[model samples]
Target: MASNWLLLRCRCGQSFGARQGTKPSCSRCGESSQITTTAVFTDPNTLTEAVANANLPSEISQQIENKLNEKKRKKLKSRDIANAGTIQRILKQSTDERGVLTLQSLRVCLDIEGVTEPSAEQIIGMAELQGVVHRAGEDEWKWLA
Candidate 1:
């Protein structure tokens, strides 16, 4: 027996399968729409291909792409910021300078440790986000705690 499933693409880029004749809601953004029989498929492969070629309205597609990119950026930012070694190095290097941290100082510390991982900008960005540092000037950073 051929199994029938409805393929759905939400404005937020979330895709899922649902039963026919049901109004499915996007888990990501809470948008819902009634399923049409034309969107139902018996073959999963054909459903995948159809979803890939589906001509979404340009505005909706753009919104979906932007949401996806934002999610990716946030994930990377969190990963970079959560590096314990980097945070400890920055804190240690800033101690002698009366808690005044600079991008150059952080870079030098990373270099001395033979860790050329995250760039100076990324480290500084993470520090700012953590509320441990703030811009003192164009090229200087003040350590908050």
Candidate 2:
């Protein structure tokens, strides 16, 4: 007996390959669709969009942003700034990395000391406001200071 192959549809109206005798939903909108083909793999981008657009908790978004940024570098990538939590984490990390971190140190940690990315200035500003670190002088800072 020939096994029926599985087919899936995306919300975007596109069709993709699925395994035989397997249950899978649309790769785009994530809606379940009728099987029309035997073997097909959904577009990777479509799957990515589907997962990203799904109903997710705010914390999940933060985690995603954190994972992406940490993968990139010591500084926040330009795209990472679009994510508020990533920016917040970067600012917090700036202060936390040192015992007596300073604005300059924050800037250095977030920008100059590593590869340049986005929101360097904004992070520096935010760190100044919320970071436990403080400026000790023209070139110095105290964490408790």
Candidate 3:
């Protein structure tokens, strides 16, 4: 199928996306110079993001990306610790007689704990990686201890 997105770079140093088969004027300068198509995509949201990222100066973009990534890693690390403790407490309260912790049970526990992020699958995967739990069935986990 034909791509619905076009990544256009203009002579004015502005980069943006447009519909395929069409040349859009530079978003930054109205420069009608040759528009170069650098990339194509089928998804409009991703295309929009690509255009925005392209418009950013390379050095500034790199710094912003690095800062965002670092903050995300830190936030996830702290939240994961808090969430792991909450999950373990929930498991003790909610694990089935066979010691299986179902995703549904995890979700309910998360809801009660007022935690909205780090989905149940994410928590389970983190626990599994930390050797705190293991998959016992298609949709359940069993405590390692």
Candidate 4:
């Protein structure tokens, strides 16, 4: 199948994406110059990744890429947890009597559940993204959902 998105580089050196067959003004310079199409991506995530990588300096790209991957994994893992009706249970199991979830509690809960991919920190980050929890103190989160 043909790609749905095109990655383009503007004269001002900004990298951006546009739908195929459409000309988009530079998001940075807004000059609407005839920018060269750099690559094609099949999905918005891949397109976003391309644009982000293009905008980053080569030396630090790997580090930033690692962080981006962690974020992506956390989002995916959180969605899985929510879909499985386990977010509430996990939150309950991982939190204390005061409804505060600690990293250690989450680790033990996940260990019991055999969910070892995301790790405690990633699960906590994901929970924060779902708006179900927020940091209440160092190494602990309070229920928001």
> Cα lDDT for residue 77, model 3?
65
- Which clashing pairs does model 1 show? none
TM-score of each: 0.39, 0.27, 0.41, 0.41
Q: Which candidate is the best by lDDT?
A: 4
lDDT of every predicted structure (CA atoms): 0.67, 0.52, 0.79, 0.80
Across 48-90, the per-residue lDDT of candidate 3 in tens digits comes to 8998788769548778999998887677664544455676676
How do the residues 1-145 of candidate 4 rate in per-residue lDDT, one tens digit apiece?
5658989998888889998877788887886766889998788889999998898874376688899988877766744343335655776899888988999998888777756556788778888988889999899799986
lDDT of 1 at 97: 48
TM-score, structure 2 vs. true: 0.27
Clashing pairs in 3: none
| Model 2 local distance difference test score | 0.52
TM-score result, candidate 4: 0.41
Q: Of 1 and 2, which scores higher on TM-score? A: 1
How many angstroms is residue 79 displaced in model 3 relative to the true structure, after the best TM-score fit? 10
Deviation in Å, model 3, residue 16 alpha carbon: 41
Please give, for residues 73-108, the per-residue lDDT of candidate 2 as tens digits: 545455433355655555556654445444554565
Error of 2 at 26 (Å): 1.2
